[model samples]
Target chain A: MKAPSLQNTLLVTGLFTASFAQAAELEITVENLTRGIAFTPILIAAHDMESHLFVTGEMASTELQAMAEGGDISGLEMVATSVAADMATNPAGGLLMPAMSTTTMLSTEQMNTQLSLVAMLLPTNDGFVGLDSWTIPETPGTYSVYLNAYDAGTEANDEVRGSGTPGEAGMPVPPPLENVIGMNGTGVAASITNDKVHIHPGNIGDAEIDGGSSDIQNTVHRWLNPVAKVTVVVSE
Target chain B: MTIRLLRMSVATALLIMLAACSDDNDDSVTEVPEEPEMRTFEVSVFNLSANQPLSPIAVIASDGGMLWHTGEAASDGLEALAEGGDNSVLIGADSTLGSTSGDAPLGAGESEMLTLSLEAGSETSISVASMLVNTNDAFSGITGVDLTTWAVGETKTYLPAVYDAGTEENTEMAGTIPGPADGGEGVSEGREALDAVTMHSGVVTADDGLPDSVLDSSHRFANPVMKIIISRVE
Candidate 1:
């Protein structure tokens, strides 16, 4: 677990040069910290600084939109391939239920100094949990980062049940999520205000389990920022 | 960044001087620098729930490991802590350098400080856990936190978020809770629903339209249910 001293390594090489020659193996653990929401297959990718999954204040790419709106990772997987990023897709097999964690080992190749993760938040139209391009520390240590929910800005959050297709109107309630999520929720909103990727304002679900407002449970599905925690142990 | 550079230069000069003083052939006397003491941290948790008191605080000090990570199922020890407000099992099982607990329950707005000391070593992390007594299985605590740069006598304060132990279900029934709010049952062993620790969605009190809930709005809370302060005490 011990790496060469960074002070000595820096003395012998340039900061960027030393980074190019040495890469740390990352042990990543992701936890779903919600009482009710379920996450579709998560996508964890390590890429160079040039690659980005989704950025704020910009329109989501068709690939990003697909994953955010439909819980599909095929489009994002292609994007990861295009950037030559190291990726681990759907490590949990299918949906990651509440209070569940998926532990995975990821080793970054030289030049992949940034990490990005994305997964659709079940019972939502275009909502997803996301971690944007975070700089990987050069120091060998364990780092923890909390992720927040985001709106992909691709579709309206109708809060009802419908198709899982991209650009669809309502939320896609899969089997496990269907039983938990309420049915015939009137709707949350007809459209979105901000048409770019942004922090999700959290679901505004009603207390009624049978039918009132949102299909999602209010006291159950609601969450603050940092809905997920990522613990990365960097090894030499 | 300039001040950091100055500090590094000073350290480098001191290190070079120390290196120069070393003799290749030490026949008489030699001096070896003492390894750094493992950093020790003392964390105190204060329960601030209205009708919901807290179970005994579970204080654990580890290098960088977590007792119960989010999205993970509550271990038996953590489940015991969340369900019954008992820290005996968790504190007993914690493999940290040191673990301690408050003697009695911490009531609403009333605070008590429990001291935990770890020998100074490379392991410079601390974690503290506790449960709200009125709910089904709501608990809260700070997790593997780096206390490396905290100098002796310095103090750090935080308001920790509440977490559902995910052991017992959040039924909020009168006979399910252990706090005075219910004067109800304690730990009943049974895996109800999703058995994993997650962020507590908070109580759906009888005041909030959950007809079955024994808790009222006074029992509800938002993020940061507890104010935690950690001080480095040699």
Candidate 2:
């Protein structure tokens, strides 16, 4: 909401020009804090002050839907490039396992003052952990920020095995994650309550491995807020 | 520049010449000096969950180091404290500079104050942890929180998130929970379900989808389980 004001100042003021001309060097580390949830290929972007990958309470873009549904960042990368964003994509090289961390050194170009990040959560139809347009601190120091899971609100969370393509109905059963996941479930919710992006209500998994409404195990798939922790060390 | 350098040297010389502790073996005790002032801190904690009573809170001040890490396994002291409503082992941890504990367990919506004292000018960090008595191996606390900025009579408050001890599975069984709701066994030897400490996934009571769970909907809880307020009393 406040991005335009920041951009206008950057355009009009000589004072802002001095500070906005130089790029910022950041050592970014993302840690998956969940016990059982695995994060798919991650995307980190440093975009212009007005740009955002996903905004809460707003409709999910087609690019966002693709990533949330299938753990694909190609669409979102196009959006970032269109906005002249500096990005580091999939630094972990693959899906980030639980309680694991990945570090990426990214430099934000001039006027790219805001940093945003997104990564799909495996075994979920459209759930992804996200950080939306956080203003990069100017002072050189180490800072910690926590992230929450957001639902794309485009597809129904069927909680069953199905396709990962956008507009698909069920969750994508990635082969590596299948060992911890259950099988032969019925389904969870057929539709969503809030259509716009919103906080995920977490997974409503059941214990029945052979046949249950949700194929995901309740104790294994569930998570609380601040699902991921990001430590950003700005070295000027 | 010369004057400024001389002034700085004089100040350093005075500071170096000043004796913090006098030698007791000396024949004459030159005006027996009193002990250095102590920094007293009052740590206040309030339980905000639905029905989860907190074990006796452990309020500690340390020079450095962390209370816990996200991916690391819980210490035996932490396991004992999280699984049961016991804080003795954690309070006795070697890293603690000074620590205190509440006399009784703090119930839901209740508040308690714990106090700790340390010699002044000791670079200190604050840490407080307490078990959620209703759950299995779930504890809420803070770690390596910098409270050295507070002056005497100043207080800083914090909201701490709940952490799974990762020492036991959150089965929500009748015979596993230790609170008044179940009055079940507390602190088993080894019932770890996960590798390390992480945020609690919240209680999935019977009312929610887990039909076999002993917990009801009333037993459910969310993050920010405790509000901790720390004050430098002296």
Candidate 3:
């Protein structure tokens, strides 16, 4: 019995070392592919496979809502830390403008084999660009992934300038977006339609600057799928 | 007979030199000249929109050539294809190695298959482009699809999204659209307000509060308005 128990301990130790040997050096670049939309401070996490930042068709967690609604990452960072996840927060240091990109490096720990990223799209209420739980490849190579805009389902897409706090009604127009976004709009939507995270239905912007149904510019603020392009380089 | 053999040997030597210069990984040199192999591909495009009629499809095979890029201005050839249903400009581009075009417009829920053949091992990518004639400067197709690794008889499918050429505005007004819904002008002379290419924001028809728009609900569409299938036949 003692010999069997010793072998079991050795087996566990061997597995631990094997996982540690798989730890990778990763360089990630996030590019805002939109022509007009701006991405807030991005939060990228390398975590275990079981963990997820936000899952489509499921209610968004409080941490995800905070980030999606207001571009806040503190809550999400705390969650990642609690799960022993490796994270690179705010690599851009500020907003990533249209067609601009930001890069960060992360040396992932053992069991951290999945990558996720999130950043709030300015001029949107609870809309964010997200990559949910993409499996990190074992082979060392460069990989590309496209991310889409997600509706947090926590607030109405009023399309008018308002608070960025959770459960808000209107979009949070930052200083840089103040002039670009419109004003004096009534509102596009008054209630959250889908209560679960899903692909954003897109902005229904108007052409009027002072008095339209929405404060977003239809020609400028709208976008299709693949709002962001992510490039990941994996190395030993 | 001796002179003919010498000419054949010289031609084979030149072919070997050109092959070595073209491909870095191809090291083996053939002692005898052989017939150049031909590779063929079949491309099928199916329209999925309610009312948007796709223009004649232009299929091009090249070596890493792209028709249009996001966040960039449309080329004159691309602008002509997107604004009007004409695909001649793109089919005649310099990068096109082998190309084919559909003879007629593919209507809603209809599909068309076009074939192209090129010298094997020369081109490594394929591109397809067609315009949604109902809207201003809206096109749907894919660019830079890698074909070097595709096996013979291998078929791949894709659901392509719509792209706004950005050469014209989405005014949806009369005389702006060129489809049968409006029968308006095709490509105008000048560029629109936002002159850089981007994914289309979709048509804002009359049902969506664009009062002056000539389009209706049928003209509106979401992402993936076309289904594309590519197969390497030979």
lDDT by residue (tens digit), candidate 2, A1-236: 58999887767786765657457999999999998888999999998877899965457899999999999999999999999999999999998999999999999887888999999997787989999988888889999999887778778777888878999788887888878777787887676644666556567778887778777888788888889999999995
Better of 2 and 3 by TM-score: 3
Q: What is the C-alpha RMSD of each candidate to the true structure, in Å?
A: 14.1, 14.8, 14.5
First chain TM-score for all predictions: 0.90, 0.92, 0.92
Which pairs clash in the backbone of model 1? A99-B71, A100-B71, B37-B120, B37-B121, B38-B119, B38-B120, B38-B121, B39-B120, B39-B121
- The parts of candidate 2 lying over 4 Å away from their true place are A1-21, B1-207, B210-234
- Candidates sorted by DockQ, descending order? 2, 3, 1
What DockQ results for candidate 3?
A: 0.03
Write the residue-wise lDDT of candidate 3 on B1-234 in tens digits: 222354477579989999988878766986887868878787877675656788999998867878888999998889999998788988888888878998988776566677778787785689999999999899999999988888899998777788999998888889988898799988889998878889887887874588999986457665666778788878
- lDDT tens readout by residue for model 3, A1-236: 99999999999999987766378899999999999999999999999988889865457899999999999999999999999999999999999999998989999986998999999998888889999888888889999999878777788777888888887678788888889888898887676645666657677788988878788898899888789999999985
Which residue pairs come into collision in candidate 2? none
Q: Which candidate ranks first by TM-score, i.e. highest?
A: 3
Ranking by TM-score: 3, 2, 1
Q: What is the DockQ of candidate 1?
A: 0.02
